[model samples]
Target: MSSQARVSRQIIIQPTGEKPRKDRPMVHYKDRAELKDSVARAARTVWPGNARISVEITGHWSACTGRIFVNNRDAASFAPIVPRTAPETEAFDFGGQAS
Candidate 1:
């Protein structure tokens, strides 16, 4: 007889304030080291930066799931800021000569 296992994963992204659109593809590993390696590879590809990553694994022998959290540097500071203003009521003269 054959048995099946249930697996799932969740990836959380920080600083960018974004999350994965869907669960990551499940992967089977022979040992804990293999699982760590796989997760590390995925993390590098998903968040390539000087970010902190953490993984949580849970489940019984027949199945396993994980959650990966990545805290990246804030990127909003590089964005340009635009000032909001009301519409001009009158047209101003651009030339040096007074209107």
Candidate 2:
């Protein structure tokens, strides 16, 4: 890795539910870069690059939490993180009719 590489990368924050809440928008990103951008934009508003970010899971199951660990810390110390794609939907989504 190059020294110029960003030591402070962007962190992601997302909410989890069986179905997305209609009232509240669920954060979705096209790719990792987009996610990073969103995080950077938010962090810039509040705190500068001095602070580091971590993701947490506050749901029933760890798997559903969609939490990610950037630094040595677990996805709990900071905020919650979610992937661009949901883990369950990663494989395939069932059709209208059941098999």
Candidate 3:
């Protein structure tokens, strides 16, 4: 996709717990301990038996009118989420930009 475009996205992040509220999909924590606690709580509510979650982050490429789907099942197993490096796309930034 080109650099200039307005995109509409649906980020489905099932974090091994009940689906997050539509208004607030992320759990913010100040520290690692706090994050761990939050995850534990979420696990209790979402999946108690170590069941894994499947994430589906889909959107449209406004520049090209193409569909995008970024998904990861069992995301909890991957402590840090990072796709292996590729030559074409050197960096991945999650921050949304105004178009």
Candidate 4:
């Protein structure tokens, strides 16, 4: 006999005033361990201290998607470190290089 289990996790970062970006796609993981690791990584990048962070999961045994929301009071602590926009990168030429 073999065991098969998997879960789809959707991570949403609700900032103070802005609405959650539903356009983003959810991430799938094989187990809870993998999901936890990925969530931690995301938390590090975005200051979840002041926003509403949620994780929705759907899978076998648990067909219904459950949502867990958390509010981080210390979110403002790391506001200065987070970049508002992507850094500018040098332009690239692929069509036979620039003359």
Candidate 5:
């Protein structure tokens, strides 16, 4: 049976090359434009300087009490690469279904 549940939507930003952690979220954005602006502002402040990072725009799907995410290197870009993704994009399920 499927019921309605709040599907949180936020753009998550993190440094790449590090193990994924389920720890509390530190930075998140609800709007793609805002996210881009934030990143741009940061870039202008303290340059990435060889630091690698990734941005994940997630929401509209359930995780089933497990990890679900996607890393799109092809979607990476200097400016707003906005995967042009929609809330219905493919699910990035990294964990099995919850029993």
Candidate 6:
């Protein structure tokens, strides 16, 4: 993308991909945490095994909502969620000359 384009010649561009969707799908509660809990309970009922069943919800809030499906029967390939990094401390270098 060139930054030198004049305002008059600029063309509006829309983002491509699965547009924004709500992390919470249902309209029952306005909270994403609430939805997660509700889904966990429902999932437990559906999957009785204690082998480790996890539910992940993702999407934007306005556009098309998300749906859930089970993939435990086969190895589910997924990228782990990246953890937020800690804030860095600003450094002030002291003159190397010995006191």
The clash count for each model shown is: 0, 4, 2, 3, 0, 5
Candidates ranked by TM-score? 1, 4, 6, 3, 2, 5
lDDT of 4 by residue, 1-99 (tens): 224345453445444456753433344445544554455445545544535654444343122223333563422111111123523221111111222
CA lDDT of each candidate? 0.39, 0.33, 0.31, 0.38, 0.31, 0.30
RMSD value for candidate 2 = 11.6
* lDDT for each residue of candidate 5 in 1-99, tens digit (9 for 90 to 100): 333332333323233354333322222233443443444333332234434433333442232111112232322222111224523233442121222
Report the poorest 10 consecutive residues by lDDT, candidate 4.
90-99
Model 5 Cα RMSD, 1 decimal? 12.5
The lDDT of model 5 is 0.31
What lDDT tens digits, residue by residue, belong to model 3 across residues 1-99?
A: 334322222222343445533332233333333333444444344444544433222232221111111232443321222235533232233222421
The positional error of residue 71 in candidate 5, measured at the CA in angstroms, is 27
**1-99 per-residue lDDT for model 2 (tens digits):** 222222222233332333332232223333344344444344333334435644333342212223434343332222333335646553232111112
Q: Clash pairs of candidate 2?
A: 55-75, 56-75, 56-79, 56-80
Candidate 5 has which clashing residue pairs, if any?
A: none
Clashing residue pairs found in predicted model 6: 21-59, 21-60, 22-59, 22-60, 22-61
Candidate number with the higher TM-score (2 or 4) = 4
Q: What is the TM-score of each candidate against the true structure?
A: 0.39, 0.26, 0.27, 0.33, 0.23, 0.32
Would you give me the overall lDDT of model 1? 0.39
Q: Which ten contiguous residues of candidate 2 have the minimum total lDDT?
A: 90-99
lDDT of 4 at 65: 26
Query: After superposing candidate 3, which stretches have Cα over 4 Å from the reference?
Result: 1-25, 48-75, 78-99
List candidate 4 segments past 4 Å from native: 1-10, 16-18, 21-26, 48-99
Rank candidates by lDDT, best first.
1, 4, 2, 3, 5, 6
lDDT of 1 at 55: 52
